[model samples]
Target: MSKIKDTSVNFENKKNLEETCAEIYAVNLISGQWILSICYYLKQGKLRFTELKNKIPNITERMLTLQLKKMEEDKLVSRTAYAEVPLRVEYELTPIGKGLLPILAQLEQWGKLHKSMSEGSAT
Candidate 1:
């Protein structure tokens, strides 16, 4: 068998690793403000476009459309269209999207605690 290696890292390596991780997390999760919320709602069940639009009251249909398109492109959501006299489309989280819920929950909890801390300090 080959000799084992020293896997420990130095200061520069640690800094680089941290920076890389932050960059990756931002790329994956920070692309759009509505993404996590959209995923959360879909986790409850599938929703039609109008239903989703109603759920997120602040978001315009145009903006929601764009965000959903991006999410679909990123493989985080799946859109299905039904063949009928009046076509109907529904959106739901893909397996990949469902995988993000726990992570989002943790981040959301962190954000809430951080916000409270900041407000307390400001007072």
Candidate 2:
């Protein structure tokens, strides 16, 4: 995702919208191509970086690291490091992140419904 400069009009408008609407603000936090997908994978259980990468083969390692870092900063995911040979780290959803699963499920259902509706209309 591209970062909008804070001084830009678009950025200002986004800040205003987020300030006025809690839902918009929440969506903004998770508004990346990979964030939702990452969360879905994490919903299963704690996973190592490589494991998460395996689940999302299309995303670059750099992008995954950035997303994980952002999620950690946003309190959506927790990271733990183990003092083992070659070093080890695991990522898991925080309670707040777990709370998003039901919401995501609803979104999935809505997407299916919309897709079918669109296809039916096209035919």
Candidate 3:
């Protein structure tokens, strides 16, 4: 049979392009203001809604709820509710979310190094 040249590039397949853009997709998913922080906290262990609110003092209740809901929807977090007199809800990172810890740790290290360098230069 004669050689058939690939026409994928010429056709510009949107689905194929998106499938290859995982880095961009990841960045977009974690771009929310408190997403990184939330992931950091959850890395320690599961936490209740109020506990998360108390840990991150500056975050408003509405914002926390919204962020948690978004994270849950994205399959990055697992939410569990306990049946009791008082409603109890907890959130923990999913396996995929746990996979991001090393990346986050690297970012943390970079931030610290950058801060130190900036301070040294300022002096």
Best by TM-score: 2
> How well is each residue in 4-123 modelled by candidate 3, as lDDT tens digits?
246655335544555789876788678866999899899999999999999999999988998899899988999999998699999999999999999999999999999999999999
Model 1 RMSD in angstroms: 10.6
Give each model's whole-structure lDDT. 0.81, 0.96, 0.87
Ranking by TM-score: 2, 3, 1
Which has the higher TM-score value, candidate number 1 or candidate number 3? Answer: 3
Task: For candidate 1, give the lDDT.
Answer: 0.81
lDDT preference between candidates 1 and 3, better one: 3
Model 3 clashing residue pairs (backbone): none
- TM-scores for every predicted model: 0.76, 0.96, 0.81
Model with the higher TM-score, candidate 1 or 2: 2
CA deviation > 4 Å runs, candidate 2: none
For model 1, how does the per-residue alpha-carbon lDDT over 58-91 read when each residue is reduced to its tens digit? Answer: 9988889988988898888999999976889999
lDDT for each residue of candidate 2 in 1-123, tens digit (9 for 90 to 100): 589998999999999999999999999989888999999999999999999999999999999999999999999999999999989999999999999999999999999999999999999
Residue range with the least summed lDDT across 10 consecutive positions in model 2 = 28-37
Look at candidate 1 and tell me the lDDT of residue 34.
Answer: 87
